[model samples]
Target: MSEQIEDRNVARAGRLDTATLSDAMDRLGIVGQCRAIKPRDAGFRMAGRAFTILYGPAASPPGTVGDFIDDVPPGHVIVLDNGGRTDATVWGDIMTEIAHRRGIAGTVIDGINRDVHLCLSLGYPVFSRDNWMRTGKDRVQVEATNVPVNIGDVRVAPSDILRGDADGLVSIPRGHEERILAAAEEIEAAENAIRKAVAGGMRLDEARAQYRYHQLQTRAEGAKP
Candidate 1:
């Protein structure tokens, strides 16, 4: 996508309501769930600017991450694309400390991460495929930051809103931000009505029908009059 389109997507993501955001995530079927590596137990609060970190044997040369940090805005997330490798860690204690000191929001790795004790103690949010003790030396290197990278079968550009917690991570595309949020809001409203109906002694199936779930499906399917 064009940079302009990407920028607009980011702008829309900035306006997402937290509740609706969560709802959208729940409705979607595992679109952007960050693999393993539970987030710190400090409660789920979205932070981070926007940075994409890529790590792999085919990754770019060394010092790429440093250049990325110097270029990207502060509070950005470091999205690591390690080709889904869980053997070598892309980010560890030292990188975590450096990223935190740089005011970055968090790190999202498509590979594994290490130094769990230090990462947890330091309270830096991390989403990864696995947790390992082996470090990325000549095995993998920082390809680039703030560049386009693929994570979980999706192409993630810079500035995408990445929200994570004990549940997992959700990577929102820049373009679909507003539409997804709107759909999520509507879904929540429909679910709330159903919730109230069930509390009023309505049967589950009856409440669902009354809420027009079938009608919504028909409309979604472009049913004829």
Candidate 2:
């Protein structure tokens, strides 16, 4: 995508919540809803392109955990895939402090993270299966960076836009971002209209029917959403 288009879409996505985007993905027959992964703090929010990192078991004499932080661009989320290991944490307070200072959008881990207080205090979003204090240093090593990785059963590639909120996180594939954004905007508009209609005392059923709410996310078989 061109820089201008990416900027516009990212800005638009920043204004939306994960719920609406999930609905859009459903309508478009795309699977972007991340399951199980949740925000460290309920108030935390983030939207940014992904900078993926993959992790795997360490070998004898174990490799270094990583020195990849400095390479991430601002406004890009750090995605760490540890194959859902909860016994060790791939992130901690130090990473959070640096990421926050560097303007990194947030960090999403397929495993767990330590130092919850620092992340919460810094107001930096960190989404993962859960949090714990055990370090992943020697247990896992950086397998690769900027490669495709899985999160909550969904495959996320580099540059995929991730939006996290109180509910959870949802990813927008770079290939289908434009269509998903447009669909999500449409869904949001209709929902907003429903709220206004109800506020004006219109019957709930009538408002839904008038706005085609029932079919908004119903995928049309074999057609693009």
Candidate 3:
């Protein structure tokens, strides 16, 4: 996708919540939900295209954790795949501060991060398995960047859109994001109509029936996304 188009999608994602997007994905038979990747703060939220990093056990006389941050484009999310290791953290206070200052959207780790307080204080969104103080300095090394990586059992490729909210994070495959956004918007509008109907003295069941609530997230076909 062009940079301009990606920017538009990211902005659109910022307006929608994860739950609604998940429902859209469900209707579309798409799988992009990142399991176990909870937000560090319930109030935290993020939306951006991914800049993925793949990690592995360090090598003998391990290479320096590459200075990848400086190259990350502003408004892009830093996606770290650490094999879900919690013993050593790949992110910390310094990283959080830098990311916030650099205009980076957020960070999501399949593993753990450090400096929870800093992230919370900066209001910088971070979705990870957990937080710890132990550094991954010599324990893990970057195996690759901008490559496909497994996050919460979901394969997230570079440039994929990810959104996180109080509930959790979900990756929207780049190839299907536009359609997903359209579907989500449609579902959200129907839900709003349902709410308005309920408030206007309509029976709850009738309101739901009018908007087809039960079938809103149900797909007409078993075709996979």
- Best by TM-score, which number? 2
lDDT tens digits, residue span 89-188, model 2: 9899888999999999999999999999998888999999999899887899998999999999999999999999999999999999998999999999
For candidate 3, list the clashing residue pairs, or say none.
Answer: none
If the candidates were sorted by their TM-score against the true structure, best first, what order would they fall in? 2, 3, 1
**Candidate 2 similarity to native, TM-score:** 0.98
Report lDDT (CA) for all predictions: 0.65, 0.93, 0.93
Write down the RMSD of all candidates, one decimal each: 5.3, 1.2, 1.1
Model 2: CA > 4 A from native? 223-225
Candidate 1 Cα RMSD after full superposition onto the native fold (Å): 5.3
lDDT of 3 by residue, 1-225 (tens): 788888999999989999999999999999988999999999999999999999999999986555799989999999999999989999998889999999999999999998899999999999999998998988999999899999999999999999999989999999999999999999999999999999999999999999999998997487475
Task: Write candidate 1's Cα lDDT for 53-134 as tens digits.
Answer: 7765734443332335555565677788889987777778887787778767778788788888876777778777778898
